[model samples]
Target: MGDRWQVEVDRGVCIGSGMCVNHAPAGFTLDSARQSHPREPETDANEPLLTAAEGCPVEAITITLLTTGEAVFPPEE
Candidate 1:
């Protein structure tokens, strides 16, 4: 099996830019309040998901290894 990631969006930092949705419409969604959210909190690692996290303007998106809780996006640096 491939790496599985846990995706999260910091609503406090989100600015409703819709960048995530634009990058991965099937992976993310914006709520009525325009807050970013992951369509599936735990999902397989994929290019679109990674792009969505990387493209977030506010760096509100976070991705971690589902099994070990290791940082994926923004890394540990």
Candidate 2:
């Protein structure tokens, strides 16, 4: 099976911080007022989505790999 990664952000926990967007622009973006949601193109397995997740001060990002059911969290500084 092809590999895929799913990303999720907890809106309630999101603090309108743009760190994720800044860290992984290709994988994330902020709304007009800097509200965070998943990016449209989707995140690549090797992309910096993990970094963005770690950059989030609120720890609101979650990444799950579909094929192996593996996951990465809290990007390392």
Candidate 3:
């Protein structure tokens, strides 16, 4: 376990592509509306989470370090 992170799925921005679910099923799932949502809001620094975020075609998933408020995935400039 490394830095704690808050995994958030922007349903408004999501396109129900399922890429995140394919990359990290443990972290995300599809809702009844066919939108992607996090199975767990808080999680450790896991590769799957990063992969899920990176795999999102619409870039709707956001992984942020809870402690420092830093955006990890879709990395900030």
Leading candidate by lDDT: 1
**Top candidate when judged by TM-score against the true structure:** 1
Could you arrange the candidates by lDDT from highest to lowest? Answer: 1, 3, 2
TM-score of each candidate structure, all chains considered together = 0.98, 0.76, 0.95
Query: Which residue ranges in model 2 land beyond 4 Å of their true spot?
Result: 1-3, 74-77
Q: Model 1 over residues 1-77: C-alpha lDDT tens digits?
A: 99999999999999999999999999999999999999999999999999999999999999999999999997897
- The sequence of per-residue lDDT tens digits that candidate 2 reaches over residues 1-77 is 44577788888898987898888888777778667888843446755777888789999888777555566664334
How much is the lDDT of residue 44 in candidate 3?
A: 83
User: Which rank order by TM-score, best down to worst?
Assistant: 1, 3, 2
Give the Å shift of residue 43 in candidate 2.
3.5
TM-score of 2: 0.76
The pairs that clash in candidate 1 are none
TM-score winner between candidates 1 and 2:
1
Model 3 gets an lDDT of 0.91
The Cα error of candidate 2 at residue 24, in Å, is 0.7
Error of 3 at 22 (Å): 0.5
Off by over 4 Å in 1: none
